[model samples]
Target: MSTPDRLIEATRELLWERGYVGTSPKAIQQHAGAGQGSMYHHFAGKPDLALAAIRRTAEEMRETAGRVLDAPGSAYERISGYLLRERDVLRGCPVGRLTMDPEVVASDALRAPVAETITWLRERLATIVREGLDRGEFTPGIAPDDIAASIVATVQGGYVLARAAGSADAFDAGVRGLLTLLAPPAGTARHTDAVVSHHPAS
Candidate 1:
């Protein structure tokens, strides 16, 4: 990668692994194999580089999520794909993890990407949920926005639960539980079967 790209990529990894407070310019330089002169030549400082990195991370998150959410499937299936999508569970959600960092939360520049990514995900998911509701794939009583929020919570909270336990089982269980709740009444054997089949063993 070029100097600027290397710096941003390194910063992204550090921010995800170490958080804003834990990451340092020196550490970023070391990780990127770039010197202070090169870093400064490419970007202003830590916060500047961090914003670039966070924005990149947020963009990648949206793209990755959109693949599953926009794929051809029932709303439950599309959501199931998102929840069950491969992830470094122990490492946690890159953007969501930033919300826990006091420094990131304190600065609007640092927090904007994180907040925007989340809001975007919820809205995208809500759109899918509404589509499902219209097709009678889901119950009419449930609100799309509410279900979307719950799905986001489950994924983010699943990361926390998995990290705390030092295993991905909790994450798997959370997804399974949500899928169970989301499945339409058992009368539609195909729909129920598809949902059950997608869940990993708990």
Candidate 2:
């Protein structure tokens, strides 16, 4: 890859593995196998490079989620696909991790992508919930936006639980729990038992 690409990729990995405070310019240069001159030549500074990396990570997250959310399936199935989709549970979420970084959260430029991606995800999920409600797949009374926020909170919180426990079981349990709550009532259009049974805990 080109020098710029190398730098961005290295920054992305470093950001995921280490927070903004830990990912230094020297560390980035060493990880990318690029010298100080090359890094400065390709980009203005660390913030510029980090922004690029963060944007890339955010875009990738959106694309991955969009695929599952847009897929041909019932609202529950599509949401199930998103929650159950393969993830490095122990490593936690790349974008979600950024929110914990003091430096990243403090900077408007650095935090924009992360915030936007999260907002986009919540909005998309809300749309799906709305669809299900409209089609009578989900019971009435629950608000789409509220349910959407809960879903995102569950996944993000699940990551923290899993990382803290040094096991993916915590994450799995959270997903199962949420799914159980989201499953329609027993005799509803989308049977609760079938929906929950379809995507067994894994």
The prediction achieving the highest lDDT against the true structure is 2
Segments in model 1 whose C-alpha atoms lie over 4 Å from true places? 189-202
Residue 63, candidate 2: alpha-carbon lDDT: 100
Q: List the residue pairs that clash in candidate 1.
A: none
Question: Candidate 1 local accuracy as lDDT?
Answer: 0.88
Off by over 4 Å in 2: 188-202
**Residue 35 of model 1: what lDDT?**
99
**Top-TM-score structure, candidate number:** 1
The lDDT of each candidate is 0.88, 0.90
lDDT, candidate 1, 1-202, per-residue tens:
8989999999999999899878999999999999999999989899999999999999999999999898987787788888887889989999999999999999999899899999999999999999988888887789899999999999999999999999888988888788878886555533545554655532
Q: Report the Cα lDDT for residue 167, model 1.
A: 89
- Counting only residues 3 or more apart in sequence or on different chains, how many pairs clash (N, Cα, C under 3 Å) in candidate 2? 0
TM-score, each model? 0.94, 0.93
